[model samples]
Target: MIQQGISPRPEAQIFDADTHLGSNTFSIGPSRTSDGSTFLAVNSHQPWEGAVTWYEAHFHSEQGLDMTGGLFPGSPMILVGHNRNLRWSFTVNHPDLVDTYVLEINPDNPNQYLFNGEWLDLEVRQAPIKVKLLGNLSWTVKQEVLWSVYGPVVRQDHGTYAIRYAGMGLVDIWEQVYRLNKATNFKEWQSAMRQGGFASFNVGYADREGNIYYLYNADLPIRTEGYDWSLYLPGDTSETLWTQYLPFDDLPQVLNPAAGFTQNSNSSPFQTTLDPDNPHPDDYSPTLGIETQMSNRALRALELLGSDESITFEEFILYKYDMTYWADSDVPRMVQMILDAPTPQDADLLDGIEILRDWDYDADPESIGATIAILTLYDLARTSKSFLGSRLVGGEFTSEEVLDSYQRTVESMLEHFGRVDVPWGDINRLIRGNVDLGLGGGPDLLHAVGG
Candidate 1:
């Protein structure tokens, strides 16, 4: 709502803005400037239901961006333009912004819950869910909404538990978003960060002032005494209500470190930049749950960015498209495990094994090796039912076992697709427009979706 600068950059400028500010009940990029300099008015909102239509109307009417069917759930985007000397971009801020606590309900009166020692009355509300069964026929299911001193209470057979997530009952996030869009300098932007209502997602920032910053933004709850925030804690006592948050300075972040660049595709912060400090794991609270897993996309981004000093747009795009998995990566291990099975191998299985063993691990439409490896791993992961999901254990495979997995993939292909020669596109697609176009990524590749 305010403007502070009026200059423009004469060079071939870049303006990138990313957003992760949609509401959980509903749904939610990079940039460059072409007009010497451009300022954009950015705003994102929560969609409690099927609100994608609203997003389409807003962008087409206001920003003239072709964003219909682009605002998928779990994916946030940003818009760019001119506001004066400020050209800003946004990316999601990732931090542990939610917490759950198990409540001890009073046996005599379910309305009263026992916390640390005292009893507290539950806040009650009503929410309706709509479902359609047949043509033009629909029904509504009304559910009781219970709240403890913390936040919303989710009831199950185990017990009633309350979840406390940042901005759970707030609607002022757009205030910060609008301010960031018009901020021209570090001071203005830092002031906006202090306002801090953003819940989670890693933030990527760039400005016309030649300043770039990264913030792992979140409004983390500061718990009361004797309560472990990690697990479900007693939820009935006033003592359990955690209303404070650590200062923004206390949050893990990188601001113009010795490393010139930083990136995150939902990966471990330990490897974001080449800086020595690298946000040590010991510094964050155990309750934060900052993910340490090194995803295929994160690994590839690091490889591409860390390998070069200067980068061009063409190189950035190419890096995004790179599909090959490093040799020591999880995808290759899946292939290697199947190939090294100890069981006796038949000629049919051996042929499939040979195809995978020599694969480049690239998930292009033409790459059969990539197809087999990805499909087999997907099946394995889908079937594993443990609490932690389908993570591979240590030293779990040899060459012969991996070859056997290759044979299984061949059999699966023949059984499901009616042939082993079906194109990868025939199975994987990116549905948009009136066409269901074939997609170009796989489970372990840099650009990927469902494994």
Candidate 2:
């Protein structure tokens, strides 16, 4: 896919990219490996350790108030501490670390499956999923589950294949987390990563020693040659079964980059760093596809974090709450495209366009102009992508349709609010901790999103 032209790349010298704060109470320690070395263990049952430690030690705030137990039942991660001795951060790593293959079944015997002229009984089990809606309203859905030598098998109309992912049955990852928590230097951290128990993530670390590093941390499988796992490959082929993983050193990474910063707002590696310090794209395989989407949040981060030199914590926090639209953002462009088009004959439509063109791009509750413009844009999106297909909408909105949507949306807002002059804050809200406060920034700003 083509990369979006939205520019901005956050290249801060981060101390830590990803680290799950270890919970002392609920965490399971590492087990002995075959070679006798212990595996990494970063996850813990207690998810509040990091947040509590940070709030109490640094901010002098109480711990239990901000803690939300582990977001996921089994997966736990956190980031805290400071200086050369400790720092870490993480990003989601979407690698094709898993695979599934359909096995050819015997037509004569349903219980027996043929593999390499040998027959084996399909392992069967039942999986029950719970569904809950209103109070005391709940139901269960049961599904037939299959298992093979490789792992679980997902049967569908097409066929059945075994499925596998990194660390499917073996290894507890928290062991590595424990090691990193105590690591005091690059070598110790390197040794932690070398353990290779982690399933997935992009990591960045910095220490009080002034050293910085970025790594794609995971146990990515080293599949046998000539298998297209991108789509389901023929499961009958034994070659599809991968027995090894690429070494941690073989993964893409950068250390102490001359550019002084590394940033990835979920975009491709091609643009992770400044021009002179960016990683070579050819280094990674196409099979391990990377993301290239540019989110408005990332774009805004790059705009400020990239160019700022003597940044302060106050400025940083303020930047996080910035809610202004950049001219290059996707939402603004859609609005602009409509505005620059030729005018239509409908009086209501022309009046709407006049209001939209006059908008200052602020979603502030008091800005009637902004309210009309955004309502019109929302209507356009609803008609173009949801209620009406592109064909039904005639490719894109005509100047007349733009006017109509503008008129209708404005009418609805007036009817609902009893006035068209409501403040932007009245519509865009950020609710948190008994606070339903009004906020700034529209749909495409740094603190992006209204309401």
Question: Whole-model lDDT for model 1 versus the true structure?
Answer: 0.56
Q: Give the poorly placed runs of model 2, Cα more than 4 Å off.
A: 1-84, 114-121, 124-145, 224-228, 309-315, 344-408, 418-422, 432-434, 442-445, 448-451
Summed over model 1, clashes come to: 40
Best by TM-score: 1
Worst 10 residues of 1 by lDDT: 20-29
lDDT of 2 by residue, 227-300 (tens): 44455545554566677777777777766665444544333445554566556667665555443444454455
Predictions in order: lDDT: 0.56, 0.54
> How far does residue 399 in candidate 1 sit from its true spot (Å)?
9.6
Candidate 1 vs. true structure, TM-score: 0.71
Estimate, for each residue in 100-120, the C-alpha lDDT of model 1 and write its tens digit: 566778899887888767778
Model 2 lDDT-worst window of ten:
23-32
